[model samples]
Target: MTNLSLQAVKKAFGPVEVLHGIDLEIAAGEFVVFVGPSGCGKSTMLRLIAGLEEITSGTLEIGGEIANSLPPAERGIAMVFQSYALYPHMTVYDNMAFGLKISGMAKPEIDQRVRRAADMLQLTPYLDRHPKKLSGGQRQRVAIGRAVTRDPKVFLFDEPLSNLDAALRVATRIEIANLKEAMPDATMVYVTHDQVEAMTLADRIVVFNDGHIEQVGTPLELYTQPANLFVARFIGSPAMNIIPFDVLKGGDRPALLIKGVSETVVSLGPDDKICAGGTGYLGIRPEHLRVARDGDMALEGAVLVSERLGELTNIHLDIGQDDPLIIKVPGMIAPRRGEKMKVTFDRENIHLFEAEGLAV
Candidate 1:
């Protein structure tokens, strides 16, 4: 019942429109992550829900009630910004209790809520310490504790872990995951450009591009079956290798062929029918391909670059195409650069897309 729903929400600054009409419904307790490259409007959409930005048109509903005109404080939502936003001079307890105190909650009640949040975040040991005295992770916890004390129906996070070191980011990410579990009924919406964060934390992810949601799905869903070349190229590390070609021109029934791979073919039906001899892109993830034997669609490619990371060897194949193909070879069997190798992938694993970037 604590869900958030956006009905054709839009935003504009003067004449420049920042977000096209966006429609999304977030269920109660769902952990949704907004992910996209810079200037993609993911953060702007988050701000729209936080009431930080006014909606130029359309409705925003929290718990089924229209809240477009509702101020942030009145919307019963607490936002944790990327900056942590804690008072440097104040003790952790005081920082956490500040909001309740300012709102004229009973002094005893404020103390009780702060203590509860401290226990939840394990901030009790550092309650008396100032923000400057705490590590980046601890101070960020205090920032979250502040929001926890307010006990808002929904929690909005704006890249809260970007400031931490690598080790601390991992630790804090786990802690935030635990926090979500502790408040299962509290709807949470997080915004991040980091794919790892999106993959690990989101129940569902919203992918944005050019001020519109390109796709929305679970992490695995987005990673495996991207809607288009943009998403196929964006979701994974090193990205999916895209080799563009003319499908229908190559053969019968509008089949897709992988050049450089000797005769590896994926026959497409009417659903994937390409304009006869028209162009399309062939996409395959690095992990799904190998440097060994290939079937009918196998190709011989030159290893333009090789990256050995102890656990795995990433072979970037200069497959005589515009889009350099990358194949993730399992284990540490290093392949030398400039060496010729046959790259293979299963037919089912191949993704076909039309000239317009729509999946076929």
Candidate 2:
């Protein structure tokens, strides 16, 4: 296992900078997943780490040694790409052993490594099969097994399951999780646009946006206490419901006025920077909103749509806002379209953001 570090890592294409002074330290044996929207530099950063792209500036270190000048082969890193680039004519065993063979490893050692990787990936039975004869998931496993046979210090995955079907993706995701457990000492870095994979598989999730590291934390930390608006909306499913509001009063507890809706006071921490007569957004998760009881502060709206997804229902309400306020109700409670409803969220669950989009 190797500890990786990037200090002020910056990448540019001539004059246009893609990554701006990125500094991160990844612990040995940690499974870190980089997640963001497309063209956000997550993939570029991965490529830089894999030595596929040269860093414009800054230092990159692997195992406490400078690796910025090293080629991919000498970096002690193995990469598994999104596409299963397996050799069609070659058997799985040969494909897995190809790298070792090219490195002039003895036949006995190459055979041992191939067999070990195949067993670890549950591909032992299909070792003799060609890529065309195997299923999509099996092909992907063969690709991963090829990398595993190298016994690399760092394992890098770039959207390794993006090509698989939904069921295959899930199954492969589980396999990856188990692989992490089995190879406890191997440092793994994965890049994915899928938040579910990032949340479930990462020891720590790195949220990237617009070529910047928006936030880096445990999955629950980023979900529960987002640093800013970008992260608040990016990490969750269905996203957090954000409503523009006028601040009537401020302090530890701030009163906000949602025009044409309702006035409510929400709790804020002592360090939260908010002021009276300011404008900002009030963020509430869908699951946080519930049917309001008497005397509770609520937003009245007409139900525009409701989705009954087995155990929970997602209710979209037209609350005289540009975007509908979404509420998640327990069980299958389907409300008729245009039906009036009042929803209230717990004060503790509400998030406050400044007009500049920074969390208050």
Candidate 3:
């Protein structure tokens, strides 16, 4: 097992800086995923770890050794890219053994490693098949098997499932997860824009935005307690609903008057910073909202659209705000357009953010 560390890592191309003082520590055998939108520098950070890009400044350590000047071949890491990058002319077994052969490994050892990786990845049955004859997933497995045969200390995957179809992506994702279980001692760093992959596959996830690290935590940690407004809006599907509000009364329990909604007192911890006459943002996830009970504080809005998606329905309501409020409820229920709908959320589900986007 190998651990990775990055201290104030910065990368720049010409006068444009891409990574801004990133500091992170990844434990041995941990699966860490980097996720962000395009041009967000997640992929650039991955390349820096792989020694494919030089760090403009700062330190990178792998297994307690400084790796800043190390070449890619000497880093003891195996990478699987989005493309399979297999030799079309070579059979699966040959493709898997090529790297070992080029490095002058003993033929017996090469055979053992190739067969072992093939068995673990379920590619043993197609060892004699060429890339042209194999399915996309199988060919990708060949690429992974080639990496596995190297037995590197760390594994890097750069959006390895992006090229496959929906079903193939799901199947390959499961295979990758199983491969991690089979090799528990191998450290892994994966980069992808898909939150589903990051949430499901990672032991911890690092969220990046605009060349800076926004937050890093386990999936549930980021989902339940985002550090700021950007993370609160980015982590969940359909995003969290944000509404502007005025602080009517600020104390241990602050009363917020949301626009077009009744005054509601929110219970906050003692350490929360809130003051009277201040304006802030109120956030609630769609799944947390429900139909209002009699005598409960509610926000009434006109139903703009109802999307009945089998297991759950997404109801969009116009609450006199810039964006419509969405409510996610179980089962199929279609409310007529322009009908008044009332919904209320629990106090515990509320998230308060100050004017500067910092969570309170």
Model 1 lDDT tens row, 1-360: 389999898899899998999999999999999988889887788888989999999899999989898988898899998899788788999999988989999999998999989988889999999999899999899999999999999999989999999898888898899999889999999988777899999999998898888899999999888998889988998789887776645355657665554445557665655533367788888998976653444667777888988888898887777767888987887777788888777767878777788887
- lDDT score of residue 47 within candidate 3: 91
Each model's lDDT: 0.85, 0.89, 0.89
Can you give the TM-score per candidate against the true fold? 0.93, 0.94, 0.94
Q: Give model 1's TM-score versus the native structure.
A: 0.93
Which ranges of candidate 1 are over 4 A from the true structure?
Answer: 248-254, 260-277, 294-296
lDDT of 3 at 223: 93
Q: Which ten residues in a row have the lowest lDDT in candidate 3?
A: 261-270
State residue 191's C-alpha deviation in candidate 2, in Å: 0.8
Instruction: Mark the regions of model 3 whose C-alpha exceeds 4 Å error after superposition.
Output: 250-253, 261-277
